[model samples]
Target: MDEVITAADASITGSKSSIIPYNLPLLSAFLSCALAQFLKLFTTWYKEKRWESRRMLSSGGMPSSHSSTVTALAVAIGFQDGTGGSTFAIAVVLACVVMYDATGVRLHAGRQAELLNQIVCELPPEHPVSSVRPLRDSLGHTPLQVFAGAVLGCIVAYLMSSS
Candidate 1:
């Protein structure tokens, strides 16, 4: 663990002793996303009263992984390049777009899928649509989830920068 951290520090300084190259922005983004997804396991268990290991790889959970990823990247870029740079501006725009889509279009689409699934289940067996598979209903996040993800991502970026 210490060695890995040393390597990361070395990488930032462009030191010859670095065991491997590491980019703080990329690392922050990935770690934030992974932590958000991993946290879904506990969140799901709290809400559903069951342990679901698959939540680590699933979407539409308490904290939005998509939001976490983008937010971390944006915050890290801002820290590295300064908020006034074109790179930081681009990153912030991208994060906003992604987070908005997650809560807006994707959330509504998931709700629609849930309604469609209910309708499909009620259809008569002879109906052509009765045999169709149900659409996935867990495809987006709530505003709270997005907010939590953003917070988590910001924390990750801060931690990475301090390291």
Candidate 2:
């Protein structure tokens, strides 16, 4: 009869032990999220002072947060995985979806809110009070807004990751 050794048992008898635990993908994802958010806040605050003559907690200015977040993620993925890799491809698709939703869906939402606010003001006091506040003016990004955000995100990610 031939003796058989199990693969698991054979591996247990192996000479060397190796341990390596590093997940670059998850790290990159988190970094992208943080960088994007921080940039958005900073840019908004800057715009308030630069153009609006006020400092606000939130405002729509030059770049859209929506664009910044996705652009950061996409650039980060490209840094982590090669630009030609599947991971980067997935990130690109996700970025496109986010940008589209921001510009198309949210843009209309803002416009609707503006119209609603105007209508509410024109109504008599007998109308039910709209407890809800006006929709924020900064919901959507113009093409310039999107472009600025994308550029900012790309620069940040490249600078941080390259270092």
Candidate 3:
């Protein structure tokens, strides 16, 4: 497939290797998101001194997985298709929107959830709402987290291109 793989030249490797690994924008995007998510484990351990394995699968952390996934897709599209193309333009726009949402609307929503959770905790046990589960506050990322995720995504896309 033109967008996925190509035949390796026999003169270069002395063998007929068909599929060259890491030649995919989709894979690069996926790997970037996974790496960012995986990094949350180490970041949590470093910051909180706890092995929070759940961070690897949870949303809203040190690095934004949403940002990483979109950014990696954009960068990979740019690298493979050039910035002047419509595909690259679409990817860039998509990335921008995702990053903005991660840092803006979603972040504020997370803050509101935290406040609601705090209020819920202060309620008396006899109250009906007091027995409800706490709201999940970790729903979004800060600007720094988004930036870090974007940088991580760019690095991953660059590596994919070079390979």
Candidate 4:
């Protein structure tokens, strides 16, 4: 009869574990972020009718990469560990904080940057501020963007977990 190796036994025996099994949650989160960023590029191309490679690296777009990453981590944790587990709880709280910051504080900060840039643009050309580069106007996501990212994260995590 074949012996069944439990997780604890396998660990104590120093058996090598596959990377995917050991790091599925982290992999899910990273993949979610990458997917969201890639989608941003397409979304921008679709709406603006111009391809912007910067969208692949920039923050604040149709879907929130930050939200997608954290939400995927949370959902992945919930799947691997029970939803009621402490790890899942921590993941959930972290996700909430990130999503809130993306949609609220960071969003407002981006707006403030836009206003500041506008003010700087109105200044005299000789002014020191006028010579400085404008603050990045797209630094955070809208609520709808965050929501879409959350949904995408959950879906990705669930699909990854099932496999």
RMSD for each of the candidates: 6.0, 7.2, 5.0, 4.7
What lDDT tens digits, residue by residue, belong to model 1 across residues 1-163?
Answer: 3545565686677745566656888999999999999999999999999999988987798999999999999999989888999988888999999999999999999999999999999999999999998998899899999999999999999999998
lDDT of 2 at 7: 73
Candidate 3, residue 42: how far the Cα is off, in Å: 0.7
Clashing pairs in 2: none
lDDT of each: 0.92, 0.65, 0.89, 0.91
Candidate 3: where is the Cα deviation over 4 Å? 1-23
Worst lDDT run of 10 residues, candidate 1, spans 1-10
Candidate 1's C-alpha runs over 4 A off are 1-20
- Tens-digit lDDT track of model 2 for 1-163: 9978687866786644324434344444455545555555566667554433331235344566556666777887788777999888987898788778777887777778788888877778777765456656556767777777677667766766776
lDDT score for residue 84 of model 2: 95
Give the Å error, residue 78, model 3.
Answer: 0.7
lDDT of candidate 4 over 1-163, digit per residue (tens): 9988788887775625545355778999999999999999888988899999999999999889999999999999988888988899899999999999998889999999999999999999999889989999898888999999999899999999999
CA shift of 129, model 4, Å:
1.6
Q: Which candidate is the best by lDDT?
A: 1
Judging by TM-score against the true structure, name the best candidate.
1
TM for every model, in the order presented, reads 0.88, 0.66, 0.86, 0.87
CA shift of 109, model 2, Å: 1.0
Runs in model 4 lying further than 4 Å from the true structure: 1-21
- TM-score of candidate 3 on Cα atoms, chains taken together: 0.86
